[model samples]
Target: MKRILILFVLAGSMLSACNKFLETKPEDFVTPDNYYNTEADLDRALNGVYNRLVDNFGRMYSRGLFSFLSISDEFFYKNITITNLKVMDFDAGQLDVGKLWEVAYQGIDRANILLENVDKPKMDETRRKAIKGEALFLRAYFYFVLVDNFGGVPLKLKSTNNPLEKYLPRASVADVYASIVNDMKGADTLVSDISSYNYNERVTKTAVEAVLARVYLTMAGEPLKDVARYNDALIYADKVINSGKHNLNPDYSRIFINHSENKYDLQECIWEIGMYGNQLGNTQLAGAVGIENGVECTDDKIGYSTGPLKITARMFNLYAATDLRRDWAIAPYKYVTNTTTGVTTKTPYTAVQIYDRTVGKWRREYETVTPKNRNYNSTNFPVIRYSDVLLMKAEAETQVSGAPTAAAYDAVNKVRRRGYGKPINTPDATVDAPAGLDKADFLTYLQDERARELAFEGLRKHDLIRWGLYLSKMQSLAVDISTNAPSGFRYGANAAKNITARNLVFPIPNTEITVNHLVTQNPNW
Candidate 1:
């Protein structure tokens, strides 16, 4: 996936690397009819669609979320007084909101263009099917983003240059999810298996199933409340497990360490966004992953990060003393590096002072790329991991069977064992979930388990929303901060305090409402 992107990036070293993405288009020079006839051209177009996940500031892995979902229970943006998206203080006109909206549509349009032209390429039938599947998967993914963030958006399926097709009305939420399920289910049969690619960056069969599991699980909760979909979610999750394509990476921290080092862990990470060198040199595939969500540091050699993201006390308290993930996911120490000699030194944080610590999951110290940029690094973001699949199975299975089934307990226990640095397949009485918990108690256990295992990974807020706990959780967190947080840091509570019912779905960007006559603002916006 990154191969095609890197080729175009190196084509013109003197030019701005950001502008090279436009080369993916046949619009400037080669026409679609002539361009879509070749395999190389198809690859370029596919890369264009994938690049949507890499566009620095607007991409999912960027600082755009220091205040959104990622900033919920697990962490908070340190500059809390600011009245922007980070603190839930902005409106539809906010610049970041508009940029993200534009970027998602850009991805959708690129996918649509490629899908429409895919049949013209006289390539191998299998390869053509794979390419089409990838496009379909990506388009559905972008729509998922829109539906998750903006409620329902105009579903743009084809490459339409006509204004009539462009200015469509919003689709209903159920219709959007129906389309997402259909597109991804079709893609599941067409894409290659995980074994087909050396990197997890490309779309694979397991990735499709993994995301389908998430979709069905989301559909079973919150606004949708289609509880019957729990069975469908369970089926998709089991499909991935039964496929024998993935397993929990033995070391919990190794998963993210691999991400920072540009390595793939196919056994655990089913799909990750591939990121390469800093925008400097021959590489242009980096984003703000480590730079925006890691421990704060000023040394470029050690990997500079203005990562103002700090771990919340609520999240830190979830981990037990023996859990290896506690120290890795949330920084247990602060950097005291000697800047002149670049001799790195980190002082361990005392247990009582863990509240001030930062997100350590994507530490820049492990990043292998040299001459790191102040704002960018080559840390790949996980789209779906095996642990997530296991957890989803545990939740969905519980919902479908009206209790924690034997398989459900096993699924969660594997993740717990791995977190405790024990053999993942072996039983661990000390750390595994206690047996015989009822449905309500099991879900309560899962809420804490998910926070401990998957925090600061951009999934917390959505999980809260789906569980119908977003408002209540934030309100409680505000109370927690008001009573316990330091005076300077009390401002961090604004994000939780500012949250309201209208915050459920971000307002459709004013930029879109201004141009798209058929589209209207979200309720209360």
Candidate 2:
């Protein structure tokens, strides 16, 4: 399934590159009346929707979203945009903010177009339904991204037929979430079973359920504080776990490395956004997160990579030496070139230096096929993994019980055990297992474990925001970094003062406000 999807994307790209036939038609020239005629047309249109997953409007290969994760304590980047985010020194005019908004709406419009024309083709009922389900899921996912970042945004459920239909007022946050839930519920029945598919690249029943769990979990947290939703969160997460369709991959590193090879663990990855080829067509995750200006050795089959993304010293120190994920998740050294000998050697970095360490999760050296350009490697981004489901289940259980239940401990311990390379079924007190705790302590533990298990996967900021700890935590982290960081590495001076309640959600883009009078800026923007 993933290969087929990649081929479709590549074929579409080839067509556009070879000729101008696939290029955009003049406005007022192309219309739904002329476009929606066959199954092949629908497939081509649907591909446009999926293309947003890797589009460079906000930096391709999930870099736009991952940029938010970089602002959290776990990671850092030297780019001016990233620096602005780290210090909370950004507003409505931020380019990426506007780009993300534009790209998401573009995807939503594409999805709406597909939904409007899905039934025009005389195709198999199951196939048609699956296509419609995918469109709904994609739209909901795009809106979810928007709502999480920009608070309330204009909702466009149907395709726009004319210029008059383009302008839309912002929908209430509650209304937007309601639509998201409705779409996911509809998709749950329309999408096919995971086992029926060869890969988890596309939507499935379990994928819908997993995303519902995430949605419900988010609803149960900040800005809403609807604690009752925690039950729904637990119910949905448990459904995914008990479905027996997925489980945690024992080798955590393999989960990521497999992405570079175009291989997937359907048993672990619920849904992965597929990326293929090299250069502009490939994923930028490795180049954005891997070692900066490092070298490779032909004899050792090592490949080189360079990027601005780096791990924070605070994040690196969070891992216990016994945890296997530490070495696999954070690189402690970079390869240095011997100018005279033309040889490269590994050099350990100073522990407390900011931006001195690199991320290890997307290692370009482990790519199964060497990349034509080291800066662009085809590494699929994992959208949701089974391990996350377990942790979320644990979180919901604790929140619902107001204390850690036996099941809650089991869920969290499973991930912790895997981190230490211990057997999932056994409790290894010395190396893997931490002692059980009460509700408050367990929730705190779950937060840290999430950072440990899922750091740099683009969930950190959302997790902090939902926990209502975003401001306080960022403020505290600033003090710690400023106090402990080596003089030259101290970069958290503005963190304490700049981050505030108004930053809970980003300002609506100034471009959006300028073009659409119905759109209002977020508070304090």
Q: What local lDDT score does residue 428 receive in model 2, on the 0 to 100 scale?
A: 69
Model 2 agreement with the true structure over 406-443: per-residue lDDT tens digits: 89988988898888887887876765435667788888
Per-residue lDDT tens digits for candidate 1, residues 130-169, read 9899989999998888888888889888775656555789
Clash totals for all models, in order? 0, 0
TM-score of 1: 0.94
Model 1 lDDT at residue 294: 80
The reply for model 1, stretches above 4 Å from the true place, is 4-28, 63-69, 163-166, 338-344
Q: The CA-based lDDT of model 2 is what? A: 0.72
Which stretches in model 2 have alpha-carbon errors above 4 Å?
1-30, 58-61, 68-70, 79-87, 280-304, 350-355, 369-371, 431-436, 492-497
